[model samples]
Target chain A: MEFGFSEDQTLLQQTVRDFLEKECTPDAVRSLWERETGRSPELWGKLSEIGLPALMVPEVYGGLGLDERDMVLVLEETGRFALAEPIVTTAVVAAPLLGRLIDTEHSAFAASWLERIASGDALVAVAPEGQPLIADAHVAYLLLLSHGDRLYAAEPDHVQLTAQPANDQSQRLFTVNWDSQKALCLASGNEGRSLQAELLDRGAFGCAAQLLGVTDRLIEMGALYASQRKQFGVAVGSFQAVKHRLANAKVDLEYGRSIIHRSAHSVSTNSPSRSVDVSMAKSFIGEAARFAAGESLQVHGAIGYTYEQDLHIWMKRAWSLDLAFGSGAWHRARIGDALTEGGLSAPHFGFEPRGL
Target chain B: MDLTYTAEQQAFRAEARSWLEASVPKQPLASFDTPEGFEAHREWEKKLHAGGFAMVPWPTEYGGRGADLLEWLIFEEEYYRAGAPGRVNQNGIFLLGPTIMEYGTPEQKARFLPKMASSEEVWAQGWSEPNAGSDMAAIQTTAIRDGDDYVINGQKTWASRGAYAHWLFGLFRTDPESSRHKGLTFVLVPMNTPGITVRPIEKINGKKAFAEVFFDDARVPVANRLGDEGAGWSVAMATAGFERGLMLRSPARFQSTARRLVELYRATLAQGGFVDAGLRNRVTQCWIRAEAYALNTYQTVSRLLAGGKIGAEASLNKIFWSELDIEMHTVALALLESRGELLPSAPAAGDVGDWLEGYIFALAGPIYAGTNEIQRNIIAERILGLPRK
Candidate 1:
């Protein structure tokens, strides 16, 4: 019962992280934040050149044919750098959703988009579940929209987007104004509803993975700053008060990380508990990331509160992602509902398989 | 990464479950803090030893099944699921047993481990003293050498199970001139030695779960020393790692508690009681934390199997599980409301479950096994490389 990443997976994640270290530096993130569109085609191209967008696309569609487990770490690298492009929304979430459409009548449409996504020629923005805003909608060539039991695929000309600036300006969120009749229906009824559920789980899983990375960065920054920024005749890190704050945050990050990895496995295997598992991951990691951001800022004193500090990039991303896909409270409530319905058993806790 | 148990592991689990199902006491045993309860638990341990399930990961020569960490975890899950009694020799099997395997001489292993596995000699930890609680290195207990024996003097407080334990293991300053951690020695002492006294300390729950041990020129053989005289600090740290890490507090224990808490929540709802959204959320959050703890332990075990050592990062596991234990109990008590205060002996207390007793015991989780505060300091300093100053 090995519960660890494979050497190949670790190497793949490291390769992405090394690339981001050079290409998606804090300066690059800040530069994108200042842009009118808050988007960087060059950075996206470089990410695609490394096969980031094709990680989850099936090999039959000129992609890598990997799953969520393979993409979780790469998504985390995107979050560690606070990459301006919607890599998670497009590559991790939308690409896989489009790939799943191969079995439906919309196979041709999905294949064309998948091929474009694999080739780095197209960007797809998936609307956050139950949220009116869609990130990177303006930059995306295609938009995957869900309405009740119907899922639609819309091109740029079929939908209108009004830019809605977020606290994390690097994320180009927009309120999409689109008509379902103008878009092509990908799936409907039971299939559409199931796909929608899968989309939410995948999105939440991706966000949880990213939050793990963001929390790790925040703690590292806090520790580094506390060590270098001295007060009271010594490094503030020498004080138990400051040290313990970051220490507690690190504890939260460690546990939340395991939950995210477990959720990745659940999503990859299409486990029956995938929805609840994703909720658990999102809720726990979301709270952990938020705590890390706050504590890191506290440790940095007034400097962290300033706009010039790079810590804000991760802090703002934490805030944005915490509320994206599904808020912690929303996911907690979903878990509460499941617990009440299922009456709390071994299966719920992943001890024994349930309907597998 | 694969998370499924192997066919052999599954078979092991099935065997353990069946054995525990048939062998576990139909009714809960009395608290091991008392004499009769201690004897009962000792008997239970013998039964477990006879079944070769006493220490799943220990070698066959030491009364174990020679299983891996994963099977041990599976055995723990079955043990808890079957409502088995708590281990009366945890201080021996979990902490010192592993330390012995790591540092003990061949003769020491032959003399100590088999008995420890069978609870023939229940062990109590003698780490903390009145003046050296969190600062354990401040231990003043001296074991001055004379001929072939060491005369032990000074006191050790908060020694878990000391009241009825057959033996006690602790660190003592071997060099009279040495201070703090230097020149210390890890020693095992028989409780029946002359000039030794054990005065039981009552816990907040009014049970003698621990004791203060005093020694005045009590002589112990040099053979009882677990490691080199000046290297006791490192040896003790290894034991602390095991205590704070995976062995002492397995996730299945809390997972079982979480399952019970969920049952309580369900029962509360079925009683037409007022259950608020916040309380429901807390219940679900507790379950999630338990699951997360289990997953984290699996990750750690996986790393260990792949030849990684558990270091200061064990501080992370200590803080997480200790707090999680308290949180689960707190939420369960909130669900019980006033009923939570009922003692097990109280009339109409059957539905109250073990929340009150469990809660009182759990409060000590963060206190013993290195206080959570101490764990945080370790994480910050050793792990994060924060300056100690």
Candidate 2:
């Protein structure tokens, strides 16, 4: 069984990373944080030009019909730069949810939004199920809101938004007040319930991917600082105490990476174990990112504590995303329930033997 | 990114499963630490060899099926799934065998490999001495060269499986004046060689899993050297890589333990025992970590097949699996509660499982294979490019 990414996937991820290195620099992110709306239409346009938003939209809707595996690495790139944009909300969550509605009565409505999203004419924000805060709700052209088993698509005029300040300023969150009667009903009943579950898994999987990116950046920063910072006439990295901390973080990141990538594959293929796989990825990567943040700050000593150093941006993002889709403890309990219910039987341990 | 096994791979798996189902002992074999248990395991290895499943990835001439790494992984999965006996020759097949394949002369390969595969000559490692445990470069064991022979002296402690092994492979300081890592040589010696004495060392559970060997003027042929005269350190490092990496500790072993742990938790729950939420979470975490380890290994095997080299980064696998092993057993014991301390033979210990013994063995995981501390240092210095003072 092959577990490596295709060369095309590698090139796509590298292209996005190179673009971010040039356009969404730490300075650019800091500048966005200072703006009132905390949005960058220019950066979003450039990303859309590179087909980031179009990657998940159906080809029938004037967009690329690539799956989660294609977009997961790009989501990781967005996280690496801590890009102050609605890429995950628009591209990862909304586009896929809308594209899935092509078979429903809301097909025309979903297609219009998907076409706009692919061509850089529209932005979408999705409120996570049961979470009141919707990120980038103000800048989004459409909002995907949920009430029980009903999913609705509403425009800014159909909903009132109250801004909620977040620790990660790059994430502009808002509490949306919307009436389901005024918004267009996309799906309901079993269809809506299943779609909502898929949304949660996709959201959590996307966040897990981003957390991996953030953790990798944090470890890189920590190692760089340790190797450069001097203490007692030697690089601080020479000290086992400092080196081991970063090394442990690296170990956590390395193990969490495969889990995240595998989850992407699971979500893309709609594997029966998708939900548990997403939870496992989210829970493990979230904790790994948090640990990396702490070790990074500890390694940097006093400098990493200051906002001027730019390390705090990633650390704050790590903290915010760890609790976003689901917290580590929440997902752990979900897994615990699944295992206890399923009885830890053979082949349930994952990568089940095919046709055996 | 396909995770599905191929048809051929599945067929191989089916073949392995059927054979193991038919041949595996109905009753569990004893621990290989005892004499009787050691022989029992050796017999099992011979049976496996006869079945062409002893060293799946090795060439056919080496008593294997000449299978790929993926098939080897599948074989390991089925091996553990069938509750097969543990490999008494693990030190040979997993560690020294690969090193020999990499560096052995044709004669050495001919003499050692097939026997190693058949458990005809089990191997023990002699890497650590009293003063050279973590800092192996400080090895004081000397093998002074003579005509076609090396006269060995000094002691090697913590020799795994040495209590019953037929052969021992170790690093010895070859130059009297050379210090640290320099002038060292990797040598293979027969345990029956004159002046070689092995004293069994009891573990915490009073099982003789390892030994301390005192080599006083033990003569070994120079032809028995694995590599160049003064390059033993690097050669042993290669062996250490195998020890700490995927070969020795396959993920199936831990995954099997994790599966059993989940069963234990369920059995405890069915008995009307109060299982705490905290312990349940820990158990779930253990299962997830085991799965993660398995996935990570598959990714690694894929990369290796693509011609990527495994370096100090192998330390990450060592740390992950070792820690996961301990955590899995710890949660099992916690589920067992007061009964966790009871030996398998104790009254009322019925179906308490081998967690207590498993826990004892897991304690050595962090200590052996270069110690987790040394692994961390390797990750930092060699991998992260950290300075060494």
Candidate 3:
């Protein structure tokens, strides 16, 4: 029983990394960050041209029809490059969410949306009920919103977006107010609830992978800077204090890698331990990202704090990702609940301001 | 990646579990440090060997079933799940046996391995000395050659199972002019050899689980050596790799401990109703770390089966597991709060706490098998490509 990715998966990872290295540099991210919408037409077109937006859509519906395992690697590359586009919101999250709605009332609409998404004609965002922070709501052509047991596939015109002051300018968040009845129905009752639950798992699991990438990049940035930064007429990395701190960060990064990979495997395969692993990845890697970002900043001395350094780009990105999909404590509490309660049944994450 | 066992592996697991379920002693065996308990442990090892279960990963001719590494992992998981007693012959079967299979001559294998598998000659490690714990190259133990025999001298400290082991394996200074890792010899010497002495050193737990072995002109044939005299350093490093990587502490051991820890946490919750979220989070954290390590080992074993060799990065694994063990037990103690101090025989004991004894034993984990500090240095220099200090 192997616990690592396959040869094909490794190849996919390398290809995505290569593509991002060419298309989505720090300059690209900085350019997008300065935009009103944080949307890059050229880069977004490149993502769709490569069939990434179709990775989860069904092949019968004119899409790549790949699994969550494939998405995991792509998401990591996105994190590594600090890609500022709505790929996670559209391709990774929405494409799959609609794929699972084939048996629901919006079967025809979901299929059409999947095709549109595959061709880069549509951008999708999610405003999942109880999870108030909606990603890319302004740019999304369709928003997947859940109300009670009903899943609605809505257009932005039917849903009002109130932009928030975002932690990571590369990716913006909005509080969405929607007319549920005006939207096309996707699913309702048990099917809808199950769909939303699975979406939450997938989203959290995807965030874990991205956090791993963020942390890995943070550590690399830290180690490289420490090696060059001089202290006492020698490299800072030569000192035990600097070495040990980076080593501890390395330890966290490595340990978090195994958990993140396991999360991807289990969630993709629908293993019995999927929820368990997702919680582990969310909680473990969330903390790892913070630690890596904090320590890397400490290692860089001062310039790391500035926007000009490019390091803060990833630092802000890691924080934004970690703060989303549940705080570490929030996921840890679910883990604690699984440890003591009904064993991870209906595991939930994030804020709910309701009935106001 | 697939994480399920094959049908054959499942069958093998069933076979091992059924045998263990029936054969494992209902009552625990005595501690190996005591004389009677030592004999009992030896007998237990003999029974395991007779069942072809002593060393599942060893080749068939060497008294194992010729099981692959994954099967060996499954065997260990089941072994611990069945509440099997600790391996009294671990030093021989896990550490030195694999080292021998790799480096021993046919004669050395024929003479030493079978007896080792059968527990007729339990072994102790002679790697550490008073002058050398983390800096193993500082060993001053000398074994000068005289005709066909080597006159052994100097002292070895912290030889686990030395007090009751029938044989001990270690490195010695074979060349007088040489220093550090040079001129050292790795040899297996019988504990019954004249001029050899074993003195059990009381540990913090008041148990003498290991001892100090002094060689005062002890004489042994040169044939006892595993490899060439000065080449011992390289062979010793391979053995250390095995110790820190796979053999000495399999992931199953920690997984089992984690399972028991969950049971403890559950029982604690049942009786008391609640633990703070911090402590509960810690319990989950420990469980996650154990599972992560187990999966990591699976990946490593898969790599090995596919022709990958373990390297100094195993120092990272050592640091990870050792620290996880300490954290798991420490949190358990905190969960116990007051009963944390209760001994195993205490009236309130319910198989839920380390009772400070196991915690005490775990304290030596990072110290032995190379201190965590040394492991970090290895990671920094070898794995991370940092400058050596």
Candidate 4:
């Protein structure tokens, strides 16, 4: 029972980190503010080239078929770099949502879209479960939106889109209004209900994982700033005030990261506690990342609050991600209900067949 | 990372579950701080020892099953799930035991471990002093060597379990002229030694859970020292690492508390009171923190099992769980509102007092085992590589 990621997962993480380090530098993240699309086509193609969008797609559908554990780390790297691409919504969420339909009536359409995603020919932006504003739908080739238990695969041309940029401008949201009668029906009834359930789970959990990564990056940034920034003829980091602030954030991030991994494992393995686990991860990490962002900015003094500073890139993303899928309050409420129903079965010692 | 238990681990869990189910008192044993309660806890430890469940993570040579960290975690989960009594020998089995295993002579192991497991002698920590609570290096308790014996003379305060413990494991100044952390010796001394005096210190809960121990030429044999003279600082830090890491506060303890807290919240909600959204959020956050801590411990345990050692970053674990414990209990107390201050024995207190008791004890968590303030400094300097000014 190993809790450490497998060698393959470790390699995947390293590869993603290295790729983002090269392709999604702070300057690259900064460039998003000026672009109308708020995304890099070249970087997008590169991510698709490395098969970031294909990781969640089934192998039978021309994709990696690797579990969320593998891609969770990738999403984390994207967060670390504050990468402005829609990997989470498009690749991680949409592709997998489609993959689960491989044995359903939408198999052919799902396969075609997945192949396009794998080949960088199309990006499918998903509006999961209840949300009306679909992120990445402004630039997406296909928009997967759900209402009730029915799912539709709509073309960009088939929908009227009004762009609603997030507080973190790296994300561009679109209020999509599509003619459901004209769109391709992916699934409905029980199949669509199941698909929607997993979609929200993966999306919410992915958001938390990404926020934790950003939290880690922010702590690193804050620590570096404190070490170099002088105050009273000493490194700011040496001051107990600055040290404790960052330390608190570091503690939060560490625990948040742990839960995110656990949540991912729960989703991947289909644990009975998966819903509670995801709720716990999202609610906790949303707060942790917010703390990291606030402390990191405070430690950076004036520079962190400025638009020109790269620190805001991750900080704003963390703030925005905290509100994604479902807010921390929403998740917490759900967990409260769950606790009322089934008082925590186990405090998840390890993932079984528990990942030791 | 998979979280499923292996068949063998599951079987061990089943075995432990059944044993604890049968052996755990239906009614809670009296507080271990009380005289009768102390003996009852001692007997409980012996029962656990006879069942080979005293120190699951320790090696067989040290009266343990040689279980790995993962199994230890599982054992802790089952132990807490079965509502087992708190380990009276926690200071021994969790902190000093691991340190001694790393630094003790084979003879020391043979002499100390079996008895510690069987509760023949319960150990208390004697690290903190009047001037050295957080700054442990400032310890002034001297143990000047006199031939094969060391004459201990100084005061150690806040020695947990000292009022009832039969033995003590602590650090002392071995060299008269050396300063700070240098020239100290880690030693184990019998509580009945001549010139030793234990004065109970009442806790916030009005319990003598700890004491102030004074020594005036208390002669202990040199063989009582665990590591070489002046190596006490590192050895004590290693012991501190154990206290901070998986040993002392297993995640299961907090998790169990979280589960109970939620149950309290559920009960509170059922009463049709104004359980505000803010209160609900805090309660959920408490449970989430517990789960995160458990997951983090498993991750750390996995790392340790795969030949990794916990270092100063253990300060992270220390701060996280300690604070989480306080928060969980605080939430539970908040759920009780006006009844929050009641003692469990009070007829009017109802079920509100256990949380109050837990909250009172948890308040001491960040203060003891090295204050969270000290822990943050370790994290800032050791983990973040920040300078100490």
Candidate 5:
């Protein structure tokens, strides 16, 4: 049996890689990062032209109907560039979650939002981690917000223009305000928290996958820098210290990949470990990004820390994403609390499937 | 992408389940935690071979079903599900069999495969030496060419299953002057050869499950050689790959065990004292990890079915479940609390001590079969394109 991606999948990946290399290059990303726009609207249309925005949407709804794996591949490539795209929020998160929430035969609100999302006209913005969120933003057709017992999405009346400078600073963040009439209840009470938790878990898993891709690129950047940037009459990469750090980075990448694999597999199977896998992966990879990025910067020496260098872009994203959902320490604490309360099953080989 | 088994596979699984249900012994089989216990387990293995349920991975020519990896996985799942005895001839059938299939002379296959399948000749691996655990290239086991035979001399440590194993398949420095990895040759030597000696090492659990074997002029026929000289490393890798990949443990077995763990948890919780909120949270977490492990196995199986080679990423699966094994046992002990101190044979303790025993056994999960540290090294160097340290 083959575990490699299918020929079609390969082509899809290659196409996206090529597109990002040619159209959404590092320079393009830097340009947007400088502008402080969360997305490239023109590029957004171009992505729609290439049909990425519709990959998860059903053909009947003017979309690609691609599977979750395919969507993940796209997101991963997007992350490699650290692209200023809301695909994760709009396509993967809001669309799918909204798809599930829609009471098909009769819900006008759901149908209208689905049509807008499918047509690639509407964009969704998720709340920054640890923020008190208002479910109404001017441009967003639907804003997902959760409180103790409720999840709401509605129209905004007098949205605030206050700047909420996010860690990624590149992605635009705004503090929003809205009245009760604009808040359409997605779910009443604690069910909303469960829904939000599930969505957050998916988001965490996706972010981990993206971070893994970024880590791979960071390692490559370090390798290239080490090869070219000479010191002591030889390429810096020739040093054992540099080599070992890169090697450890490689180990982190592999570990992160395995964790992501476990998380993805759990999500696909609706396994009980879905949350745990997601938590472990988010925790592990968050730390991995920090290490890999720092090592990569060190490998590149002084140039890496400069704003002019593309390396800082990755470092910024890495730091930003590390703290995005929950930091590594946060997830670690969750796991630690669980282990202290209940004995860990398969603690060392947590996800290895053997004869149980 | 489909993880579901075929109709033929389903039928095979059904037949296997029924056979196991009808034939499984009432009492627990001898454990592999000790060398003596392993020998006791071998007798149970003979019963398996007599019934033709052992060695399903071997081809039909050797009296097996000529099954593929999928069937082998299924067979292993059923073996563990039935609470079957530990594989006494695992080294012979799992490691050596596959290596022989790829590189053995026809005469060698014909001579050894059937006997190996039937448990007539159990085997142990002789790869790691005291100085060459991770760096197998540094092996010092010498096999000097002699008239019609090889005179072998050196020591092999941590040769798993060696205490009662009948034979050994290993690499030797056939050309000492040659470069480290270039001088090796794979060979099979009888465990009880005149010049051979074995001493079992007791583990923390007071069980002797692995041994250190020494050889002094252990004359073995050239016919026992596997593949050509200088090609021992590749052959050994192929053997180790199978051991680590599919044979050491199958996903189905783990899936069943996970289910059983849940059952055990439910039973333990039924006692009420253990049902605190913290315990409940942990139980849920363990349930999640177990489920994730099972799904990952399914994904691996699906990949295999889709015609992919299980490569370095197979180590990913290995790392995942090995950690899980430790976690599972640790959880079991926490469930037992103070009773976790009991020895397996203690009169006051029943199976409660098995959890503590398993907890100790779990410590080795990441150590042997290539330490998780080494696995991470491989992942970085090979899988992740990281620089070699």
Candidate 6:
């Protein structure tokens, strides 16, 4: 197996890293946090125009159709800047969900919608929370997974919304009421379940990759702050306690990144054992991000606690997504379950997410 | 880009696993923590050697299977899966064998390698001194020039199996006037040589895994010198590379241990209900970390199969896996609660208290080979290209 990144993926990562660093800074993150909408529509359009959402879409559908590592690079860069965008939610998650839909009975509708989403022509926000038909926020589409069949997608307008205060000021959560009339059934029966599971696995990979970025950036920021900020006439970083903490954080970051790379490879190849891997990645990286972010805040002391500083942006970003899909604890249980089951089920490729 | 094994590799794995399943000893060793344990395990090694499962990468003349690395990795994974005993002569076969293959005189290979593969002699490492753990370059174990031989008069600590080793191979200073590295020479000395003394160190676990050796004019023939007289530094480094990097403890060993830990955890949980949240959390963490290391090792092997060099980053794998072993055993102990404090002789014993015993053995992990702190420094300065401290 080739562990090295493909030349194209390497170039793509470099390009996206440059784009995010140039276009979005901590100030940009702050501006987005202050806004009620939390995301930048104008910047979203630019990313869409540049085919940011289409990297994983097949070339036949007028998209780049790159692999999971490419998306990992994009999400990683997006996370580095703490970009307040749902490229992860829209491009990596919803768009791919729609891509799966196109291969099923809903091809006609999914095809047009996917093409529009791939280009900058259309927009789709993830279902805020609650259920598919119960979103509290307005969006072009609501993504939901049902137990028996495919994901039932409903328009936000058709669902009754209930608002809840989110942990991060930049992001809000919503609960929705189900309305089959307004929903488009993406995948059903075995296909639907299979599609949703695969998508979640992929999304878990994306989340882990994003967390690696978050942890790496926070570690760098914390180390720099410790070295530059002096306490008692010496650099705080010089203290053994601080150094050990940073060292531990660095170890956590490396371990987290290693799992992400492995999980990405597993998903890309349709390895049947991807669940155990994804669970391991999500659980390990989830804690690593939490630890790194918490230690960063501690190292920075009082200023880091204040909303004015940029560290909380990353802290909130990690916390929000970490709890959204599943917390570290949840993944840990999954790992335990997999281990107790003797081993994980081997991953099967080419089979639709539905059915065995 | 495919990480999956080929059909041939898969078949080879099945074959190895089946053979090991039939051949591996059913009874666990009397002790995995002593020199006697090493000797006891040596019989198992001999059985494997006779079965053609030993030294898979070496040539047929050397009593090897003449297989490639993928086959070797498959064999290793399956060996662990089958719960085979640890290779008692690992130092001789893993490190010295490869070094001799590359840099030894033909006579040296003929004399040493076959005996090593066949377990006729067990080898011990004599590199670290009391003053030189992380700073191995500062070794003060001197080997003064003598007529037709080198008279060594220094001490080495933390020598694995040295107390019962048949022979020892490592660096000794031959030119005190030269730089620390330049004055050194790698030599093989029979443990039975005159003026040699070995004192086994009873560790916190009460097992003697290491020893301290004293040489009061211990003479090793000039013919036993490896490579050149003054080129010992590089030769020792090659052996250390194998010891610390490739197939040292074998990935399969850790994989099997991890698998067993998971099984043991589940069984304990079944026999008893949830003892505490903290212990459960730790158990889960250990299992996952171990699995991650297994994957990391596979990636390392795959890289080698694809003709890539294993860089210093490989140190991270050892650091990760060893620490995980410690953590897993720690969790296992806390789960046992008061029962964990009991001796092996106590009634209502659990799993021979191997986990508890292993927990104690694992305490030396960061202190041996190289400290975890030193490993991090290597990663930071060498792999990450950070500036030196």
The DockQ leader among the candidates is 2
Write model 5 residue lDDT over A249-307, tens digit each, in one string: 76556656655765665555556656667788887778888899989999899999887
**On lDDT, who's better, 1 or 3?**
1
Order of the predicted models by lDDT, top scorer first: 2, 1, 4, 3, 6, 5
The list of candidate 4 runs beyond 4 A from truth reads A341-356
Candidate 6, residues A1-356, lDDT tens digits: the string is 34446668878888888888878888887777677666677887878767898877777777888767677767778777777666666667667777767756888777776777677555555532223321115444544534355567766567676666677765656665556666777767777667767766766777788888888788777777877787788877666566656666777777676577778777766677677677788888888888989888888889889977788888987886576555688778776666564455211111112121
Separate clash counts for every candidate = 0, 0, 0, 19, 34, 19
Q: Score chain B of each candidate by TM-score.
A: 0.99, 0.99, 0.97, 0.98, 0.92, 0.92
lDDT of 4 by residue, A1-356 (tens): 66778889989999999988988888877777789888788888888889888887777777888988887888888888888788877877788777777787777887888898877778778877779788888788988778889878889889999887678788888898889988888888997787787778878988887887799999999999999999789998999999999999989888888888888888888887777788888988898999989999999999888977789888888889998888888888888776665554333323322432
- Measured by TM-score, how close is model 6 to the native structure? 0.87
- Lowest-lDDT window of 10 residues in candidate 2 chain A? A343-352
Docking class of 3: acceptable
Using lDDT as the yardstick, the better of models 2 and 6 is: 2
Candidate 2 structure quality by residue, lDDT tens digits, A1-356: 89988899999999999999999999999999889999888888898899988998888787888988878888888888887787777888888898788888888888899999999888888876798888888998999888899888899999999999999988888898999999988888998888888878888898999888899999999999999999899999999999899999999999899899899999988988888999999999999999999999999999999979989999999999998878989888888888986633535657656457
Better of 2 and 3 by lDDT: 2
The alpha-carbon deviation from the true structure for residue A188 of candidate 3, after best TM-score superposition, in angstroms, is 1.5
For model 4, state the Cα shift of residue B80 in Å. Answer: 1.7
Q: Which scores higher on DockQ, 5 or 6?
A: 6
Q: Estimate, for each residue in A220-252, the C-alpha lDDT of model 1 and write its tens digit.
A: 999999998878899999999999999999999
Question: How much is the TM-score of the A chain of model 6?
Answer: 0.89
Question: Over the full model, what C-alpha lDDT does candidate 2 score relative to the true structure?
Answer: 0.90
Residue ranges of candidate 3 with Cα displaced over 4 Å: A344-356, B347-354
Q: Could you give me the TM-score of model 2 versus the true structure?
A: 0.98
Candidate 1, chain A: TM-score? 0.97
